[model samples]
Target chain A: MKIHIYQIAITLISSLMIFKGFENYIKGKNGQTVLKLLVRIIVWGGMVLIALFPRFTNILASTIGMEGNINAIILTGFILVFLMIFKLLSAIERLEQSLSQVTRNETLKEIKKED
Target chain B: MTYFENSKIFIVIPAFNEETVIQGVIKEVQSAGYENIVVIDDGSSDNTQAKAAELIGKMAFRHKINRGKGGATKTGIEAAKLLGADIIVTIDGDGQHDPKDIAKIIAPILEKKCGVVLGTRLLNPKGMPLWKIFANHFGNFCTWFLFGLWVTDSQSGFRAYSKHAAELINTRADRYEYDSEVIREIHLHKLKFKEIPVAVRYTKYSMGKIHKQGFINGFKTLYKMIWGLIS
Candidate 1:
């Protein structure tokens, strides 16, 4: 029945993020796809649940056949971080290619103007 | 000389921040009987564009942002193609490549011996730094491993492309890996390519340029080549 300071902090942060995600979805910012919005909601909602009820992680760990809840949480956090990093890298590479193409086309267009 | 008179040879010099030597490099290419010079200033913060523009007959195109050497070279190639270039020769803007050898590299293309002529410095690497020689060989090995085609100097920027070859070899790399990509294009398209010995001038100024590919860049180029293959 004891509520720790860390638990309150995490719940507050996750709730704020969840509210912001829904607000953006309502405002149609970044062309928010349904699947993207669903994923964001699931991730933030899961964090809020875990912060509010630390015992939920024990159930998750048992379902995943893990001995300890801390190990399960750490492993899932690492996987999520790595997936986000990979996605960001790929996106950056795509943006770089687009920028190069635009610059190249503009330079070539100047030749046509001169002729 | 008569062959050059018949062909519209465009000398493409892809430069980035080479303000001190752009004019000299332009003059050298001009003195070597190549009047159609296209200098692609790859978003240089210095006076490279202004210096190149000072030369009346040469064409200077500026990129709104820096896109590395490969991007600049590709832009230059595209511009040269639009300008009706029959034979396009790409040279470094740092004056490291001798404009005198332009005739030698383009001879094979002019004679219809090959669609692409690669100027190899390894054939006669006199006055070339020892470390550069080693790095070039490593680059050649990496190119062979990644693309399954090998040349003496896969990293050499001094090259000549016939109109047909230039039109066919469309590369996607926007960095140093572009040279290796050209080799891959040659392999994939079955374009006839000839490698000939060409002279390289390594001066204090060229050696001092920060943009030159060093130990770290070589690995980065290799990584990009592999990533291109996978993605």
Candidate 2:
């Protein structure tokens, strides 16, 4: 029942993150901000719980039918990275769309000048 | 007989670093009696824009940055539409495509046989490189797989489009994959497509360009096609 120094530090940091998330959520003016803040709090809270009670990961692994906690963590991490990549790709797609628009507009202007 | 004399046909030449060939292509298109010609310079570092600019009173649009061939083609098409073009024929700025074929390709669309006229190089692949023939067949296979239609040459850049077909074909591919994407768009929009046998001359320069495009570009286009379909 002895809590490690590292666990205490991680918990404190996670609590601070959760507090910041809540503050942002309360001050958020849009649905996107609120959703982002909520996700941040949940992720930080999960980190804190995992840091304090690492054995919970074993239970999660068992529930998920994984061989070990490491496997479960790896799978979750993979999914998080995958989702992040998809989000980044969507942003890139938007940028590409705007770039194309600008390119089209500029070309149109040039054509007008010639005409 | 002047087939397209009454029709407003715009020849859209999309050029990228084709400083050596752009002027010739423009002159050839003009000499063929097609007055409505637009050369879209796709932001080449070299003198592509300058070469295109040499032709006085020609409609040329210059992109500020390199937006790929697809982006350039789209820009050229937009210019053609602005000029009140009834038929848009997209040809590469490279001198490989015969400007005379513009009339031949548009004939099907003019006759109301198809909404789009695709120039197929497979009919007479005489001087084309071996790699291009292979890449073209591979592209044809992909088109069949994606659209369930067997086309002779799906990746040929020389194609003719009616105003209806050109406006309806919406594609997001900004690179070499745009050719394949155009085929997919034609199928998705249910536009009637006709493939005509056209001759392509493969110079040492064009052969190098084709070899450079090679398999890597083909694979990239396939990946983009899949991405376009799902996303």
Q: Write the per-residue lDDT of candidate 2 for residues B61-122, one digit (tens) a residue.
A: 78899888888898888889878888999998878889888878999988989999999999
State the C-alpha lDDT per candidate: 0.90, 0.82
CAPRI quality level assigned to candidate 2 from its DockQ score: acceptable
Task: Assign candidate 1 its CAPRI class.
Answer: acceptable
Q: Which stretches of candidate 2 lie above 4 Å from their native place?
A: A1-60, A110-115, B1-3, B56-58, B210-212
- Against the native complex, each candidate's DockQ, computed on alpha carbons, is 0.49, 0.44
Q: Chain A alone, TM-score for each of the models?
A: 0.72, 0.63
Models 1 onward score TM values of 0.77, 0.82
Enumerate residue pairs that collide in model 1. Answer: none
